[model samples]
Target: MSKYGLGSPLKVVKKPGETLTLSCRGSGSSFGCCSMHWIRQQAGKPLVWMGCVNSDSSGNDYSESFKSRTEIIRDNSKSMVYLKLSGLTAEDSAVYYCARNSL
Candidate 1:
């Protein structure tokens, strides 16, 4: 594996009012030592910051637009993070991304 790698599905399809969970996994010496963040980009729109979970799973910070409907979780042992969005709608259709930052 690469020094630092992240993976997620290339495509996902969901319907309104449904719930969706997207997973991101990382591999590297420092993979689980920092926060993981989620972002999305829609057609003709700039990327939107969704939220993030601290590395130790102690806290979270979410954008106001997503504060009520989104939840973030991390599993350090597995080097994975998850973003769960509830009450999905057409507005949620976009390309999602997972990113990390040094603590």
Candidate 2:
């Protein structure tokens, strides 16, 4: 079990050329002080670090492969983080995860 509980949908379906938005809601006192990371793992494949956004909305960074197609947003007031991916394709399918980390 995790000290800070994070909630997200079990699955999402989208078609090619469509956009997808995934939400991650976290609960804990320290949630607002940490950065949120979005990662994905395909079947039998290694985890891929997609991107991250600061809780304070100070900044964000994305992996080279996802830089142009992904966006991460954090809303501390709602204790939620979001991952938006555009120009989707079959190759974008994967199991996504959201993790919190202290600065």
Candidate 3:
């Protein structure tokens, strides 16, 4: 078993044609304005920016490839963001990181 269960218990659920909500918590203080960015990494390679959500009010900003496929919404009161991927596939498998970008 792995410490973070990456290899042992890979908690991946295939949503297929349905929309799946992936929740993430930011690695920043809750009191300040920390914009969250979603990044994707495949096979220990360099990470690619998928989208970002402002913790204050504005909704989200996504890359061109994610225009109609991905969404990053949040419940700021809970300090949590929900990432919904409309379509799922084997190629979508990667390590997603939720980072905070402060201005």
Alpha-carbon TM-score of each model against the true structure: 0.90, 0.89, 0.75
Query: How far in Å is the alpha carbon of 73 misplaced in model 2?
Result: 0.6
Regions of candidate 3 where Cα sits further than 4 Å from its true position: 1-10, 27-32
Q: Which candidate is the best by lDDT?
A: 1
lDDT score of residue 37 within candidate 2 = 90
| Model 1 C-alpha lDDT per residue in residues 1-103, reported as the tens digit of each score | 1112444357778889999998888877687788889998898999888999988999999999999999999999988898999999999999888888854
lDDT by residue for model 2 (20-101), tens: 9988888767789878898888988998889888769899999999999999998898888989999999988898888877
Look at candidate 2 and tell me the lDDT of residue 14.
93
Poorest stretch of ten by lDDT in candidate 1 = 1-10
Listing every candidate in turn, what is its Cα RMSD in Å to the true structure after a full C-alpha superposition? 3.1, 2.5, 5.2
On residues 1-103, what C-alpha lDDT tens digit does candidate 3 reach at each position? 0111112223556756776666764433551376667777778688888887776757689999877999887666767776777887777778766666645
lDDT of candidates 1 onward, in order: 0.85, 0.84, 0.66
- The deviation in Å at residue 93 for candidate 3 is 1.1
Per-prediction count of colliding residue pairs?
0, 0, 0
Better of 2 and 3 by lDDT: 2
lDDT of 1 at 17: 98
